[model samples]
Target: MMLIEETTVADDALPVEAFKAHLRLGSGFGQDTVQEPVLRSFLRAAMSAIEARTGKVLMQRSFSLSLTFWRDAEAQPLPVAPVTEVTRVALVARDGVQTDVAEATYWLERDSQHPKVRAARACLPQVPTAGAVLIAFDAGYSAAWDGLPSDLQQAVLMLAAHFYEYRDDTGLSAGCMPFGVSSMIERYKILRLGMGAGQ
Candidate 1:
C-alpha cells in the first residue's frame, strides 16, 4: 500500500521571486516580460500546499523551479532532487530466533534531515505495535538480521504491507522492501523437508 501527500515550503519565507527573475534573465526568457511576482505567488501557494499536506519544507537554494501553462490551464511544477540513491530495508530478530517462526524488527533509513521521518517518529507510538521501531539516516545504509520464526512472519508482513501501501500513495521515492518474513518462512519449510537450500 502507498500513502499520498504533498509537501511545500512557504514562498514569503524565501526570495523565490528574485530567484525566478534571475533564472528568466539568465535563460533569455525576456527579463522585461517575465512576471516574477505572479510566478512567485503561484510557487508560494503551491509549495505551501504541498508542505501543509506532507510536512516537508524544501530549501530554495537546493532546487531549481519551472512553470508551464497551456491554454487557460496551468500546472504547478515541483522541485526535483538531482541525486538518486537507494533505500535500505532490514529485519531484526526480536528474541534471537533462528527459525521461521520468530518475532522481528523493521527499520527504514532515510535522510536524517528529512522532516517526514521526524514527524513519523513522533507518531510512532500511536502505531499500536509494541516492539516496532523507526530510525532515520543520512546516507545509504543496510543491515542483516537473524532469521525469525513462522508466527512472527505474519505480523511483520502486516507491518510491511502497511508501509508499502503508505509509501505507494505518497510521492516520495524509496527502495526499501519486505524480505525476511516470507524468505525465512520458505527457508524453514525447506529445512523441514531436509533440503539444504537457503535464501
Candidate 2:
C-alpha cells in the first residue's frame, strides 16, 4: 500500500505572525523583515516532525491511498486522522479498465483518531482481479493553522523555538525530538500492535 499527499498547506495559511509572537520576535524592526524565512522553515520542519511522530496531518490536505485489496470488505481504515471527506474511490483492473465506485456505495467514518471508509451496505463493491483500489480523501484538523488544537499549536511553537535556538548546533542526533513536544503529542500517536492490514 502507498499513501501520497496530493496537496500541501499554503505558505500564507501558516500562522507566521503568531509564531513570531511566540518566539518573542518583533514584527517589524526598521524597514526590513529579517528572519522571516528562517522562522518559516523552522515552523515547517517542526510541523513535519510532529506529524511524523503523531501520524496526524496538521493541515487539511488531499491524499490518495492505493491498495491491492481491502483489509476488511465491510470497512477500510484510513491512515490519517480527522478525514473531512472521501472525494473518490476507483478500482483499476488488470485489463486497464477503471470503474468509479458509486457515491451511494460507501460512506466516510470520520472518527477523530481513526477515520475509515465504510460500505454503505453490508459489503463494499467488488474489486477486479489484479486490480488496485485508490481512495482519495481530505484529512486534518483544518486548512489553516488557527484550526489546530491548542495543545498541538503550542507543541509546534515549542518545537520551532527549540529548532531556532539550536540552529547553529551540528552535533544533534538524527532522531532527536524535544521532550516537551513529545509530551504534548503523546496522546495523539496511533499505536499499532503487530497488525498489518489496517493502518
Candidate 3:
C-alpha cells in the first residue's frame, strides 16, 4: 500500500505574516522579509511534526491512497482525519488500464478521528487481480490558519517559534518537541485500544 500526497498546501496558505507577528518581529523596513524563507521552513517542519504526532491534517490538501486490495469491501478507513471529500476511486489493472468508479457507487462516512469510504451498495468496486485500487480524497481542518481550532493554531505557532529560537543550537536533541506543543495536541492524537489492530 502506498499513500501519496497528490496536492500540497500552497505556500500562501501558511501563516507567514501571522508567524512574524507571533515572533514580534518588526516590519515595513524590509528586514523581517529577509528571514521569511527560514521562517517558512520552520513553520512547515513544525506542521509536519504536529501532523505526525496527531491524526489531524491542519491544512487542506489532496491525498491518494493506493492499495492492492481493500481491508474491508464495505468500508475502508481513510488514512487521515477531517476529510472534506472523496474525489475519486479507480481500479488500475496491471496492464495500466483505468476504470473509474461512479460517485453513486460509494460515499464518505465522516468522522473526527476516522473517516471512511463506504460502498453505497454492498461493497466497494472490486480490484482486478494483480491490480490496485486508488482512492483520492481531501482532508484537513481548514484551508486557512484562521479556520483552524484556536488550540491547534496556537500549537503550530508555538512549535514553529520553538524551531526558530533553537535554529542555531547545535546541542539540541533530535525530535525535540516542546511541552506546550505536546499539551496542545494531546487530544488530537489517535489512541488505540489494542483491539482490532488490523484496521
Reference-based lDDT, each prediction: 0.29, 0.87, 0.90
Instruction: Give the per-residue lDDT digits (tens) of candidate 3, residues 19-103.
Output: 9999999888957579888989999999999998997888998999999999899999888888999999999999989899999
Output the worst ten-in-a-row residue range by lDDT, candidate 2. Answer: 26-35
Candidate 3 is scored at a TM of: 0.94
Instruction: Pick out the ten consecutive residues of candidate 3 with the lowest summed lDDT.
Output: 190-199
* TM-score for each predicted model, relative to the true structure: 0.21, 0.90, 0.94
Better of 1 and 2 by TM-score: 2
Error of 2 at 173 (Å): 4.0
Task: Arrange candidates by lDDT, descending.
Answer: 3, 2, 1
Tens-digit lDDT track of model 2 for 118-172: 9999999887888899999998888878789999999999999999989888887
Per-model clash counts, in order, read 23, 0, 0
Worst window of 10 by summed lDDT in candidate 1: 68-77
Global Cα lDDT for candidate 2: 0.87
Ranking by TM-score: 3, 2, 1
Model 1 regions lying over 4 Å from their true place: 20-37, 41-104, 111-199
